[model samples]
Target: MNVLLVGCGRMGGAMARGWNGAHRVLVFDPMAAELPDGAERVDSLDAVEVEGELAVVLAVKPQVFPSIGETLRPLAAQGALFVSIMAGITLTGLGDALGSGRVVRTMPNTPAAIGQGITAAVAGRDVRMGDLATVNGLLEPTGQVVWIDDEAQIDAVTAVSGSGPAYFFRFTEALAKAGAQAGLPPALSMQLARATFTGAAALAGADPAELAELRRQVTSPGGTTAAGIAEMDLNHAIDVIVQAVVDAAAARSRELAG
Candidate 1:
């Protein structure tokens, strides 16, 4: 398959790097940055003169979509499948701008840079089964891919998976700080925090129940874990943290919609 990436910024560059061996890739970025050894780099869309059986990946900022949209309208009309990685832009919004029916809007997190990201995508009204198959093939190199039927759910997915990593990182930082306050050396505290969260995440992945159940199994009356749980549970700290994150992200998603 032939793939053309419109922007070679962080996300686009990551996708190019990850998908290198899977397809014939061409990158169109004005900066003239280095790409994978065998990948073709075109300075601009005008420099890209060939077209046929192409999958166009749009990694440009949402603000630039209008101008780029006009430029890409012809390509879309010519039968190229459009896949957008811009956040907050709905499939309907993209379809209106690109004048194409075969559009897929994807919300991919920064972890995609390391081939460990999770992406949630929703197809536009004009997307066909073959188009979706092509998209799945193109995204296979990035990480796990999920297709959602409802476009509205993309915002919630964005909140949960897209912003989820940063939340964990913050928790890790707090864990390290707490450990230091409790008397562990700073370096040791950080190391333990990292290891503990990593192991817990792995365990959670292996288990199918709610995380609260896992916590219960590890807690015993009059134990250190129980005391810590008591402190954490006081005044519904966990619920407040979860609601704060989800609400902030969902509101941001709505703001981006405009």
Candidate 2:
């Protein structure tokens, strides 16, 4: 497969790393410090020369995309499929700028740099089903891939998955702080928090049962874990807090899209 990678930054770099040796990549980024595997690096879009149809990946920050589109239009006009990993840039906006409706808009988190991220994607109305396979293949290197039919759902996905990592990090930090306040040494508290978080996540990944059921299994009826759960769920506080967080993030995403 041939890929025209436009911007080899963290996410782009990760995608390139995933495609290494498996695909021939034509990259354009004046500021790239290093080129990825099997890449024919170019300083400008004009320098790009390839024979077959290519997948032009828009991996640059959304803010820079306005000007970038002027240079990138030719690629779209050249009959390439557009797969964008930039956030807050809607499929309508990309299609309008590129003068092509065959676009795939995706929101991928920072974890993608390590191939552990999950991406939520939606294709433009003009996109064909076959085109999705190309998009999935391109993103498979980063991690898991999920599709949505309603583009609007992408905003919710952005709120949950796109910005989810930071929420987990903050919770882990607070948990460690709470342990230290409960009389444990600071170093020991942090170590315990990190280990517990990591182990719990690994277990959740391995378990096939529903998350709520898993929680019930770990929590004995009259144990300390039940006490902790009671505190966390008092007045449905945990659910309310999570919903609030997602709402705030989704609202911000909508604002940025405009």
Q: Best candidate, lDDT-wise?
A: 2
lDDT of 2 by residue, 1-258 (tens): 789898899889889988988788888888997887678887788766678768899988888889878777777787789999988899989998888998999998888888989999999878887899999999999999999988888889999999999999899999999999999999999999999998988898899989999999999999999999999899999999999999999999999888
| lDDT values for all models | 0.85, 0.89
The true-versus-predicted C-alpha distance at residue 156 of model 2, in Å, is: 0.5
Residue pairs of candidate 1 with colliding backbone atoms: none
lDDT of 1 by residue, 1-258 (tens): 778898888778878887777788988877755776567987667555554688899998888777778788877877888999998788878888888879998988888877778899899888888898898877776788999999888878888998999999999999999999999999999999999998998899889989989988999989999998888789999889898889899889988987
Which residue pairs in candidate 2 collide? none
Judged by whole-model lDDT over C-alpha atoms, candidate 2 comes out at 0.89
TM-score of each: 0.91, 0.96
